[model samples]
Target chain A: MMVDQFVAQIRRLGHGVIDAVMRLGFAARFFMALILASGTGLRRFSLVVREIYFAGFMSLIIISVSGLFVGMVLGLQGYNTLQRFGSESALGVLVALSLLRELGPVVAALLFASRAGTAMTAEIGLMKSTEQLVAMDMMAVNPLARVIAPKFWAGVLSMPLLAAIFSAVGIFGGYLIGVRFIGVDAGTFWSQMQAQVSVRTDILYGVYKSFVFGVVVTAIALFEGFDAPATAEGVSRATTRTVVISSLAILVLDFVLTAFMLGGN
Target chain B: MERSTYDLWVGLFVVAGLVALLALAFKAGNLGASSIGSSYVVKANFDDVGGLKVRAPVKASGVVVGRVTSIRFDPVRYQAQVTMKIGDAYRFPRDTTASILTSGLLGDQYVGLDAGGDSVMLKNGDTIHLTQSAIVIEKLIGQFLFNKASGGGKSPSSSTAKAGGL
Candidate 1:
């Protein structure tokens, strides 16, 4: 009887792994379909523009405010730490590098996942639950092309832009705290930042990371919604999954990409 | 909201994002300062580069005129070969001296160019002969200690001769 129980446990684990692999395969196919259908949405440019308005413009205030606060805190903390070493002038380098290389892209993408990604999931999940997708199919209109692709494109387009704004505002906030409040020399602050931060490596790599994050976050959100079960509870679960899954994916991908970019040296 | 209003707002949003990126590139980065258009490359060799890195500023007097493009080790000569891209606007004589210099007490290292009296200007790919290697602080301290141990009576010129012998 004990051996039979052990065999049952092993079988359960194998089934769980197989289920995960199948779902991943399904997600890949869904992603391919979304890409193939994207041209239809692009042809009607207004669809993409409208989605951009919802996904990008609507999230600006939160992204900017959080960016500023994060930068200010970095400045205060960096100043305190660097002061001990008598290298307070290096505060600018610390703030700028952290924000540009890591915080700006990662935090902005996380926020994007929570704010806009959940909304996209909920909207699509609701449409699916209410049978709007089935109705579109009945009328020979592809819901993926009409509804999902525009949002995918908008999310992709907005992410790098949002991350850029976040870094820029964060730098300003750091300046306010470091140079204005803390009385570190303003010339040294700006000059040190310029001296240390390279455009190709730091800023451009950050933008690239944000762009990849946008694609990942949006795809996961859409996939979760599209794959939701046709019920209210299912829609809610998918919405929550959109936030959780995308956030985890963003973090994991960030690690992988950073290792590839910076770990060689 | 009106459709047109959405379009207008999205346009502004995109413009703002682009502006922010431009600000990052120019203000926070070395983009504006590094725009040394139409430059010529010059090479220099040194015994040691220390912590000097590629893209470090190549300054004439105190003003930056160019940037270090690359650094390579020549196994045959047991030296470091540094290539710099200098702007065509600032012409240096062929006999210009390139020395690695550190800024402030504990700051970044850069290449300092001391122009020599030569009518001929350095052209592209010309190797600078009068190059000074980076001063390692530990080596300087060791030399100081050695000088003190010897008898505190040695002239500075003799110290220089010993250093050159190394």
Candidate 2:
């Protein structure tokens, strides 16, 4: 009996692994379809505009405020540490490098996942639960093209912009703290930053990172929503899952991309 | 008309993003500004460059006059060959001294130039003759420790004076 039970458990585990692999394959296929359909969907320009308004413009205040605060904290901490070595003029380099290299993309992505990703998931989950997707199918319309594609592209396009704004505001915040509060020489702070940070290596790579993060976060949100059970409770659960999954995915992908992009340098 | 309004907003958003990107490139990377004027190439050789890197600022009396364009090893001489691109506005004498220096206590390395009293000005492709290598802190500390151990608690300054005389 014991032997039979152990064999059954092993079989179940194998099946579970296969099931997960199949689900991942399905997700990849769906993502490709979304990309393919986006070209035609772009012709429906109004829909994309509306989605961009909702996804991009709506999140600006939060991103800006958080970026400023984060920069101030970096300046304060960096000043204290650099003061120990009497190299406090390097505060700008420290703040700019930290934000451009790591913090800007990761923090903006996490915020995007929490704020907009959850909203997208919840909206789609509600539409699914209310059978609106079925109505579109019956009317011979592709819901993926009409509904999901615009939002996905909007998120993808908005991420880099948001991250840039975040870094810009953060730099201003750093200047206020480092120069005004800490009495670091303003010229040194700015010049040192310009001398050290590279356009191709630091800023452009940050944009690339945010772009990848945007796609991953939006895809997870939409996928979770579409796959949710057709119930009110399911919609809420899907929204929560979107935030949790997208946050984890953003961090993991950041690590992988950083290792690939920055390992040698 | 509504679509036009939306398109306008999108355009504005795109412009904002571009502006932010330009600001970052200007403030952090010093792009576009470098090309405002032409620069000429000059070379220097050093025994040790320490942490000096390509694109490090080349300063003359604390003002940036150029940038280090490349760093290569001269296998024959066992020295570092540094190429610099200096702005056309500044002219230096042929006997000018080039020294590798750190910005602060713990900071990035840069090339510092000291103007010489020579009447002949340096042109493009001229190699600087007098060059001082970077002071590596670890090497200095090691040397100090070695001297201290050998001298059996004698003053470090006395040993340093003797070594300099030698």
Candidate 3:
């Protein structure tokens, strides 16, 4: 009797978890479709550009510092091992691949989500609290256009550029740590990095992942913001939820994509 | 405030340009060396590969002169065999030592050659005779931790060194 009951409880718990995941996935898809299909939203071009600069440029310090440290760690650890086999010269190639394929986009996206996602959620939530969305609706203007599109485009535009900056600067960080500190041959390191690289597909994969992250992050922010009640407390709740959900969604999506791409891993 | 169509176009162009530039930079870096001097190809056998992968740089005396082209496990020998392509200019003496070496501490692994003293130079298809295996840092660290744990709180300088003491 006890074993049968335990099995039933476990099955119920598993079903509940699966149902929750499906609901989140369905919501994300619907939200993504809505944002993509809205055309006049793109007409708010200046707003998008400004938001891009604001979110990405303002957050450059955090990205650079993080890039520097990861690069340093890679260099330090890579140098010690390569020293044993006496192939320390190829540090640049290793560093470049690490930054380009993995670290750059993931870190940039996380940083961008923290900064921009929270802001978007708060702005939309505030509009809800003050009933400005209702006012815009009565004026025959789309609130989604006035609010969500700019945030969405900002996320999409900034992420790729931010990833690029992280990739470039990250190589320099590796160079400083690996070549200068660890006594790897700087010239050979650069030479290998230049010579042997994966195809355009590798970089394209990163950019595509950034685009996916943008959509996921913006959708979570918009949904949470729009769902918030017409109160200051509700706005705060929306802001918190948006940040948490967007960050989690970014990681979950990243894991899913990574598993799909690197199948059998 | 609405950005004009022209502004959007400019922004698009700038973004496209940056993307193109980054792609070109990476492309030129990767393809240039291979196109210039890809010549001799040879294979080396290893007991373990560690983190070595295809396209990793192969170096002689800390200078990159080649790259690993392929990796395959030899079922018969129960070992990983790495095939490498060296520049035409980099001819090794017959007694050269080839080792699977990593780039840096956290970097990827590559094949490294230590040129040896032999009168006859190695040819295009000759196999390198001597090979050192890959050294993984995590494994070494694990060994160290295990040694400290098991040595009854005594220093394991003697036993630890004998147990792949790297």
Candidate 4:
């Protein structure tokens, strides 16, 4: 009986692996469909604009607020630590580098995944459950072109910009705490940051990271929703999966990108 | 929301993002004051460069005049060859001395140029003579430790004089 149970468990595990691989393959094909159908989506630019408004503008308040708080915390913590080493002036360098290189892209993407990504999954999943996608197919209207491609493009366009805004606000918050409140030399703070941070390496790399995250997060969210079972429970589960899977993907991609970008120097 | 309203908001969002990117580039990065344009390159050789890295600011009397463009090791001379690009806005004499200096005790290293009294300005491709290598802190500390261990039996004043020579 024990041997039989062990064999059954092994089979179950293999089944799970196969299921995941099949889902991943399906997602890839869906992504390729999105790209191919993007021409039609772009032709009706209003759809993309509406999606951008929802995905980008709607999330701005939370991103800015969280960015400010994160920066203020970084400033406070960095000041206390750097003061011990008598390098309080270098606080600007620390704050800017951390925010621009790591925190901005990663945190903003995480926020985007939770807020915008979940909404994308839920909306699409609901439409799928209601047979809207099938209805569109019956009418010879491709939902991939009409619905999914627009959302995907909006995500790809908005993420880097959102991440930029987050970093910029975070830097201001750091300046407020470090220079204005803590009395670190204002000149040294700005000058040192400018001197240390290269536009190409630090800022451009951050933008590139966000762009990749946008594509990944949007793809996963849409894929989960589109592939979700036609039930309320399935849509809800897919929404949750969008958040969990995208967050994990963001972090793993961040590590790989950072190593690839900075390992040379 | 109406279609027009969506378009307006999207427009505003894109503009805001662009503005933020510009602020980051100008304020927090070296975009506004980058001196890589129309620059003249000069080479300097050092026995040791320590922590001096490529793209480090090359300052003349505390003002940044150029950047270190490249650092290469010369197997022939067993020295580090540093190429610096100086902005054409500033001119330094041919006899200028390039010495690597640190900002604070633990700060990043930079090349300091002390212009010598020379009538001729340094042109592109000129090798700067009288270059001082970066002070390796480990060697200094090790020497100090070695001095103390060796001179433990001698008078303390003698060791003090020897240490001062460094």
Q: lDDT per residue, candidate 2, A1-265, as tens digits?
A: 9999999999999999999898789889989888888876799877888777777777878888999999999999999998887778778999999998788899999999988898899888888889998899789988899999999988998899989988988888999999998889898899889887889899999999999999999999999888889998898898898989899999999999999998856
Q: Can you tell me which runs of candidate 1 are displaced by over 4 Å?
A: A263-265, B148-166
Best by DockQ: 4
lDDT of 1 by residue, A1-265 (tens): 9999999999999999999999999999999999999999999988999999999999899999999999999999999999887778788899999999999999999999999999999999999989999999899999999999999999999999999999999999999999999899998899889989999999999999999999999999999999999899998999999999999999999999999889753
For TM-score, candidate 2 versus 4, the one ahead is: 4
* Candidate 2: regions farther than 4 A off: A1-8, B1-12, B138-166
Better of 1 and 2 by lDDT: 1
Over the stretch B1-166, how does candidate 2's per-residue lDDT look in tens digits? 4777767777777677678778998987678545537888999999999999998889998888998999999999999999999999999999999999877556788999999999999999999999999977777778788978887576665554453332
Off by over 4 Å in 3: A1-33, B1-166
- Poorest lDDT segment (10 consecutive residues) of candidate 3 chain B: B157-166
For model 1, what is the alpha-carbon lDDT of residue B74?
91
Clashes of 2: 0
Candidate 2 achieves a global lDDT of 0.87
Error of 4 at B104 (Å): 0.9
Per residue, candidate 3 scores C-alpha lDDT tens digits across B71-113 of: 9998998988889888898789989999876553445567779
By lDDT rank, best first, the candidates go 1, 4, 2, 3
| lDDT by residue for model 3 (A1-265), tens | 9999999999999999998798678767747655764576677566666666555556667766776788788788777876777667667777877777777778778777777777777888888888898999899977777666776777677677767666666777788898788677777778667755555545556666777887777677777777778888998888888778777877888889878766732
All candidates: TM-score? 0.94, 0.90, 0.62, 0.94
The DockQ figures for the candidates are: 0.75, 0.53, 0.13, 0.77
Question: What's the CA error at residue A229 for candidate 4, in Å?
Answer: 1.7
How does candidate 2 fare on TM-score?
0.90
